[model samples]
Target: MAEQRRRLDPAARRLEIIETAERLLARDGETVRVEDVVAAAGAAKGTFYHYFPTWDDLLDALRTRTFEHFDARYQLPTEVDGPIDWMRVLDELAAAFVGFTLGQERLHDVLFHSDFARRRPLPADQNATIRLAAVIRAGQEAGVFAGLDPEPTARLLFAVLHETADAVAEGEDCERSLAALQVVLRRALAARPEEGSAQ
Candidate 1:
């Protein structure tokens, strides 16, 4: 008699499909096909279509998962007893961004730099840049960062980090790029001398 295969619940099964695709993506990049994913996942073609109606749908889901995975690394505490070390927080956030990009270089490129991804923008509120902007606002309140609008500064800083990580992924010197990032971030966000004096 054939052994019975245990069935996974909806959420678990969906996650399994996504996880399988991630592995295939890491191994094969954007060239990975839905057939490859389904085969590796041990699921039927109908199952893959049931979860993701189209290939683009799957890519969209992957982008969301990747963004959330990166965001989870730098979530700030909602409550604090004393003054926050905004600069330290920023450093850690920068590290997380660069580290994730480099560690998942292939996946990152497929999900972010791909033409398909560029056509489908992630929602604003759920994006990683918004979270970084919140940190910038806090830093401004604490007189650690410049008093400029947090949104655009956060956007610029995020771009810098992205480019830096991409350069490193393309075989540039990691240490030097990181050091340059630190300098750029500090200089760009640091409180002006006048602002410090006023405080």
Candidate 2:
């Protein structure tokens, strides 16, 4: 029964450990020990060790978890009645961007300023960018959006969103920063017609 019980808790324990560790690591971006997570999660050190034997394991888990969360939020829809519009996409990205920055206050500043971001410019967010780029490409193919360079456009949008997240993570007015990001991104990506606009 002990083995079965371990199995039962493995899934839950693993996530709990990761989530707890992410929350803590975000704080000031300092080192997080196994004992800290164990105490916070009210689990034995063995439980944390079972999930992540090393500190690097914990960091990798946190990065993966954050990316997973970001990806899940990336392709979500807005309440707009029409098909996916540039405004809607920008709004969604802004919301997700703000959510990631604001929700993980402890890690945001450190993550942005640390070598992690600079070191990995094309982090796991590239997966999300590829996913969103495909959607934008579909929009263009379907004639919803004007034809344009999808790759550069998507990267530009991501850069804007990242900058907004940085501002928020730096303790600026996060909500306002998100709103500003939405405006900036929308203006940058708003589709123009293939046909010349009449005066």
| Structural similarity to truth (TM-score) of each candidate | 0.88, 0.70
- Model 2 quality (TM-score): 0.70
- Candidate 2 segments whose C-alpha is farther than 4 A from its true place: 1-8, 42-46, 71-74, 77-82, 109-126, 174-176, 194-199
Q: Ten consecutive residues with minimal summed lDDT in candidate 2? A: 119-128
Over the stretch 1-23, how does candidate 2's per-residue lDDT look in tens digits?
44553565578878877777777
What does candidate 1's lDDT look like per residue over 1-199, in tens digits? Answer: 1122226787887898999998888878988998899888788889889989988899888888887776576677554577778888888788788988787747777877788767887678667678789999988888789988888888889999999998888899988988889889999999887864645
Clashing pairs in 2: 26-106, 26-107, 27-106
Q: lDDT of all the models against the reference?
A: 0.83, 0.67
Judged by lDDT against the true structure, how good is candidate 1? 0.83
